[model samples]
Target chain A: MNTDAATAASAERSGSLLNLEAVVVAFGGLQALGGVDLKVWKGDRLALLGPNGAGKTTLFNVIAGDIKPTSGRVIIKGIDCTELPARFRPRLGVARTYQKTRLFRGLTVEDNLYLAQTGRSGRHLALLRSGVDAEFRERARAMAETVWLADVVGVTAGDLSHGQQRQLEIGMALVTGPEFVMLDEPASGLSRGERERLVQLLLSLDADITLLLIEHDMDVALRAAQRVMVMNEGETVASGTPDEIRVDPLVHSIYLGSEAGLGGADP
Target chain B: MSPTGAAPGRVQSRRTLRRLLSARNVVVAAATALALLLPLFGSNFFVEFVMTRTMILGIAAATIVFLAAYGGMVSLAQYLLAGVAGFMVGNAVVAQDAWSKGLKLGWNPWVAVLFALAVTTAVAFVLGALASRTTGIYFLMITLTYAVIGYYVFGSITPLSGFGGITGIDPPGLFEDHPQRMYLALVVLSVLVYVAFRVLAVTPFGLALQGIRDDPVRMASLGFNVSLHRTLAFTLAGFTAGLAGVFNVWWNGQIDPTSISIGPTLDLLIVAVIGGTLSLEGAWLGAFVFVAANNYLRNLPLVDHIGITEARFNTIVGVLVLLIMILSPDGLAGIIDRIRLGLRRLVQLSRGSGAGPAEAAAGSAP
Candidate 1:
């Protein structure tokens, strides 16, 4: 039964970029995720939708190698990285932004983006400034422009407005040029205009990069993502294209009381 | 477009020019120049002894500041590392007097200095490796434990440290003959160290260290090996502390266990805190304050009237430190920054009345 479920979940395994086989995570007696199986194909835009405490962020953490699943294999780019630490994720072309927006508050936006780039490629022990540093600086500037933070590139992350900080969080995640990007609620605190811009930015990303976004805003999530997966009580309740997930009765029932409508409504 | 009708490039250049001529920069430049020419005005006792002592202590305190401010590792083992270098210098170099019993390998002073630095750096790397895995209070405690262990080792090892410590150590001939030249060399070294740290603060590694300081978990997720970065910072601080140690042994003409004890360790930390743990320049300012207070504060008529002489010197320093902390938690550097900001505001206010609001807003944008 378990093998059948695993095969069923990862049926399209030929072009799969990320595969989670029987991933289970438990915090003592409470099970955060119970035997979850998932497969993300290359260039896939998958939106993970779930209510509060539904194990969406936990799955992202496990995939990002921040938290090792209690019992399961996390295969990314055909490599088994279940036991690998978070620092090794960059080598596998994986980047993730935290739900709480973890940023180096004391550093400027440019420095934050530059550090994200350098952490993946540049030597951490190079004491002397070099020509390569100039290239990284230029790339950081380009990323700032990409995130619509060009005007405030020199401002410290801590001093930025909440919307701007969220934008910068996305910028840092994308600066490393990872093949797979996971954004946990990138529009959590953004204004309506900023949210629209963020959706546009998400749509404008390279088609070759796989994106897994966790968002509560049905409007932003449905508009940006091609595929949608719904999780409830640490289990996959439903998975389908954006349109199918919107019309599904189970999704409506799960989200109706809390979110009111599955249609593009601002929740 | 700027209201001043200047090109963006020209505006940037103008801002840079303004920064170059800012009040703080002018004051710093003037002070550096004065320090370089201090020997001409001051008595030999003041210039040679007090000034040189301040520079040595300043270098030591700078290591603590570098580790704490940039790396966020408040290490108390900096002085112990310096003491290691001093011990190496004493053991490796030839003693001037026959009464001193040590290895006395009679190596060249410069060579011995290099050797001492190498040893100190190795020890620092080892200590960093041990303590980098821990953070906050645990890191402080582990480093403090190392300092205590070092003190005991130095005190117990009579063969190398000698009963009273390896004394009769002689400086190179150039410094030994000319006190002013020695002081000037120290000044030059201090400037170099200061500039080196400033340049380092903007480098990729330096920025990464600061990132780790601000958020180690975020840094780790970004693929930075947080522990390795912390360890490397500790090793670099060790090298700097070693530099201070070599100079200190030369200046004092000896190496003793008392120098690395818990008391002196705390004293170095106090110096760093008083100078401003966030600024490198605070190291010297703090050291100068500490050295001056230690030397002259007890001689005041007020102290005599209070019936507290040199025996209560620490009490006087404690009160001063308490006052400074109450006034400015960031230390002297914080006070200086506030004063500079106040002066800039005053200047802006005067200019605002003449130029109107638009230009004032642009000027105060930063």
Candidate 2:
């Protein structure tokens, strides 16, 4: 309703690489995702920004193969994953983190990393013989250390703080080396220190790891994502470089509004 | 020292399951060793009767534990699978009236037993598949329903079952009809099954089941076919139960549809619950409790007066189930774990106080 120009700047980068040409999804009488055409490349760090009711997460669900688009294709690495089951998407290197982070509540943090690893996943007999694969454990240890959670390996996932859980969830996704990782509101429940650490972590990741993040915080979204996609009422309103979308007359009232939120952040 | 002689002992108790030579395993192994050595001092009747029966029944209940612990399933039909062999073998052995009503597949006793296992496993696999999609009460109901169907089918299928119970089903002569000798055979079967399940409980796929138990939706999103893995867990459970069934027939030398009936199934569930749903050793202890309780209850004077005979054991069983469900939601194993944890904490606290107040307070601070 407010930032029409902010959405208009969304360069028509969609409908080319990871094509979702005119995708739509509706549940009962409610339209959740309406005719979205998004094209994402290998290095694209795109952010989906909207109010609480906007279908930012609904779009992430579509990309992660959790839900099927109503008459739209989802191609990953030129493989048509539109109708593939939820499990196969991860194998195709598409990973996701829930807005409400989901870690194995009962298992230790290290075991969570073990479960996330996609190695030695055969029959019971073979698993017994091979044990935990050494290579995967090494990879997991590296991922765990990167998130600054090396000390909490013995701690259960449920024991970790909310901010720590967020870090752990991201570490889990990173374990699999997903080609496209979709994170839903990583900055949602974080404190200032945690948010700063998260931003640094995002900035430190390799440019080749394509990220599609959804955050209501414009400042976090702008700092982390190279391009931002603005959604209003289940449709992409705008997509453009963070700088272009920031000063747009449409984005001003939509995101920053009368007040640009705490600490007078520039829109 | 609350003036009770049953005050806590100073000897350290092993609570954690992490240690290789912990108290639990040591106790279990020591008891098993005692059982194995019992035949030397005991009368022929003691060795021939109780010890023999304990090992045989132990094998049966252990099979049930494998499913519950690793797969996180409560299979009520485990004993029914074993009963198929039991009644069939018994009838073949004792059919003295005229001739035993053998299926006349003309196979050797061992071959016939193996065939029975194969058929039962296939049926169980199909049942497991149907029930695998559901969880909690719904899954339990599905498996229980199948147990009823199995019971009914074993009776009505006259082509294999005939009008009466299976007759002329004799156990093969490996034990030479010696009950104590049969105990050795049973001990072998029990050990094999235990080792097989123990190896699996720590394996990756087994850990996957734990993952599913924690959060199936998360597991699915992590690139796993949750249903398929659960079904496999069920099938493996069925397979072990079927193997136990083979031993059961040899032990009993009988066959009847009642082998797969609800009574035996419920017994398996009871054994699994009392043992502890989490650990492999839980079921072994559960089986010991089951045998001991059954023997004790049958001997009580009121069993006859209250109609709690072998045939009418349900009234008593229902009470026991209710008590266990209330008192031990995580079952006997969980109860034991809590006590051990309490002891460990006490020891830790006592040691901390010895270090003095200020240092002790800081050392144990969260």
Candidate 3:
């Protein structure tokens, strides 16, 4: 995944603690991101929106420290972490879930959560005589239950059903205790009821935790996010409340298939 | 398949066994213990020639297993890495100017060994970095290329004044030409190497390496620099192979182009794969089978009866590899572990199914 140049740069400076400014990125002649700027305060649930190739996912990549931008700076929680590596950013409390989910197929749910925790890497399997492992296991189980994964503690993340895997992905991101959490298409491949349950889960997620999410399902985004930034042609064309975005002609033109397949996005 | 009872024996036997000692662990421990004591009660000739060779080869194979089983890297260059050590020793004792010519020098054998090890570690790092950039068949191709180039370079290089490969390379004699004394020295080295590897196998590095083999992308997304992990594994494996190389010179009392050639490299692979690439002892077993069989085959009259010759060894090896591949992906270790697990399950059935069962097994099951 390509990270935002601006976000990655700030992450490099203040060690990714969170601020991104006027990030611009392009691929060949296509402007994937154009002077896009956003500020994420702690506990703010921000939603990024746009039609295909609008650079919605590109924004997620930028902030998650996966892809470097053409130019930009990202500061996390007042710390500059523009150049921090993906693993190092996590130590500064940044974590994200992929649109299709990325979990260890061979590792069980417990390990999935365990690996996702943000801290200095240590030997988790080093046989220790101390009782510290008990505390760690308890903490991991509590995190698993928070995402309703306790019943399937031993099930591999790869073997879980689509909805369960999604839940496991969220649980893993949470285990890291990241101050800023970003998710791309978390509602994908979910039944209606599963989507509703996921919405509820997101609403009930811990306070003092910031979230930036991208979803094509309008209903889920409306319910889960406090604000929506509508992207068009690799730029934020409109920013407003959910109700405001619902009736905005520009938002409708891009998302409602009213543009007759605009942006060169083939059906 | 029965949901309750009378399940297919194949499926039933596959049910895992989590005991005080796992089958794999038991096999590893027993193998190490047996090898450790072999020289103790054996005859002097056996101790000097056979056991010494076994320990040296065992160390090499063990290191190979470390890479194959844990790192999931199958390469033909491990012997070449070992060859790095041969020349290191060659520099120390073979050339009159070797010690004088080399960058760092000391007449002390231990320092020479350490110097050899340092060189090997550096080379291993470079090789590992290159190999980690690719995957699957590309890795094999890269390693094979290294083997070919390393062989020719060692044979042709003149700055070292190569004479059909450096000869007269011998570590300072610890026992004044006493074979039994040499055996003791090798036994100590082998035991130390084994313990070091065993400790590392259970470390964070080992787990991450295995994770990469199962799924590289997942490990990478989890913030692991997957390429770095792989390169590190290759480096460690190379270092171990290099250690075996220096020991090889002492075992044979000579170092030559053949020392670094593809012949020994393939032999190392045969030892590793036939023994079973899933466990640490696979290489040891594979080497024993090939070395012992080749020796026995040489004594037979098959050359007269069937026109067999030295060339037949390659075909014979090919046949064994094919059989092992078809019969057990786990190799002999897989078969032995299965049987041991089956016996444990039978005993458990006779009693009652235990509370916590198997901890979700270690192997990747179908």
Candidate 4:
């Protein structure tokens, strides 16, 4: 309802991608997300940082259309999509990964990536053989290489290591050529070396692909994202350049404490 | 470097050759040859009655396997769907006479067959939509309920189903003249259905169905219509079951309410499990074992010593099913897979080295 002139003008601009206006979600008596407003512009690498139970994942689900907000609007690419179901979101160029890895464990890495590539537009009922899609098969193999999984493309996903599964999850999301990608805690359960590689992968993404990351690792989040938004108890507490949020006294007290020694490092 | 490159090409060709002659392929080829040669035995009661019945029952059971193994839906309505086709064919093709009382449309047999398939598939789609809302045990219960309803409906509808069932329902002229032709036709159709199911498993639709079976929520999030895929799988299974129904009526020369009853419905489930729910070929193998036990087990001296007779045949089947479930949950197919794997391991050990690339390729075939 609070449509300010600046916000209205931004919504009309071609650069505007996702806009949430007073989005609220209530599970019976508990209010998971109390009225929240956010805007994501094209090509922006935005990090959503919040402590545990701060409703970050819940908000991510709302944006991904997995959960409908109790009230208010979800605008994606200048279109209202609050009532749209999750299956149709991919056609709108929206792709996401869950906090818990949701790869098709019984399928091979190539099959997993191929399904993602064809999920939005492929004729799922066609009886054509898997080898018939020579073009998509090539693209899936290329995606496997992108995620550093070229050697084990034929291996079942359930056999992959924890860090490798995380990489495959990202590869599935990117294979669809989505314009907006949301990754929920991509760095969780990853080793130090894997985390560094994840950050490099994130930073090297196409500039045209907007990324919305929910990460707990301060090192990965701060290094990969150019702009950061901090949330606390279901409200946006601060939004600015990553460096500004790192130095904010409120952000420090509520989220980053002295325990996170990497929080203040410039590197 | 030149010698190494030429050697690698030779090894690749050798691996390909080994893969072509893998154990699974050899078994399939041998089975096909045996089925094709079965007519040479001449028209005995065993060939016409027992073997033909096995193929027909196997086709019905294969539909059950398709849904359970690939789609993760353990439906009990497969036999009922087959009965639908049988009844439709009976009603559509059978001429009204003094003894037979029915619609007696007197339509051509081929037209009647297609109509029956369409009607049964439609019914399956509807029932599938209803069952797709539930999963696991609930799905089984719903499909069982449908089978029960079908039995009662057919039994109560005398004008159409004839409480006693329509008799003297003749097969098409081509099959009516020669019993061996019918048997051979069934064998050919069964083989085609098996091949089609195997091919479907690797298709995009088949892979997506497997994905939905494993995790419907994940499939939905990945932009797949989970409910649609499930319902379509049911429809496809229904069509296959309908074909079995048409064959059943032709084989028996009649369609009756007793065929769709709960007892026979569960028997089909037994057949599928014994064959190996995981392997399409297991359907026929299970059916052959079931038909053989039904026909010959009661005549054995061992059975007479044990005081078990033909009337208690189900008791023997129950014990067999229980043994299969306990020893090998995947059924006869699982047993076959284990044997093949064991043989491969033994060969590798006999060679006194780890598996070479060619041996490894052959080991993973199928």
**What is candidate 4's TM-score for chain A?**
0.92
Question: Residue-wise lDDT of candidate 4 within B1-366, one digit each (tens)?
Answer: 112565798876776787668677679879888877987874577889889999999999999999988888899999999999999999998875536856787888999999999999999999999888788899999999999999999999887797689877788899996888998899899988888887798788988888877667667777888888999999999999999999899888887898799999999999999998877889999999999999989878888888889988989989999999999999998998898778878887998976566554344332
What is every candidate's C-alpha DockQ against the true complex, given to 2 decimals? 0.50, 0.31, 0.21, 0.49
Candidate 2 CAPRI classification by DockQ: acceptable
* DockQ score for model 2: 0.31
All-Cα superposition RMSD per candidate: 4.6, 8.5, 7.7, 4.2
In candidate 1 the C-alpha lDDT for residue B348 amounts to 73
Candidate 3 local lDDT, residue A66? 73
TM-score of each: 0.92, 0.85, 0.78, 0.92
Write model 1 residue lDDT over A202-262, tens digit each, in one string. 9999999999999998889988899999998898999999888877888888855544574
lDDT per model, in order? 0.87, 0.70, 0.71, 0.86
Question: Pick by lDDT: which candidate is best?
Answer: 1
**Could you give candidate 2's per-residue lDDT for residues B204-245 as a string of tens digits?**
776677778777777778887788888877777776777677
How do the residues A1-267 of candidate 4 rate in per-residue lDDT, one tens digit apiece? 245445545664766889899999999998888999998998999999989988899999999889999998999877788998888788768999989998878778888887787678766777885554666777888999998998778778888998899999999898888889999999998898888888999999999899999998888889999999988888889999988987888888888766465434456
Runs in model 1 with CA error above 4 Å?
Answer: A1-13, A263-267, B1-23, B95-97, B350-366
lDDT per residue as tens, model 2, A1-267: 234323322322332236576778898788998888888887789998877777888888887778888777776655667898788777556778989888877666766777787522433234543434555656666787888888776677887898889888888887877767888888878898888888899888888788999987777888999998888888888889988877666766665565445234443
What would the per-residue lDDT of candidate 1 be over residues B124-164, giving only the tens digit for each residue? 99999989988889999999999999999999988878888
Between candidates 2 and 3, the TM-score winner: 2
Task: Give, for candidate 1 chain B, the lowest lDDT window spanning 10 residues.
Answer: B357-366
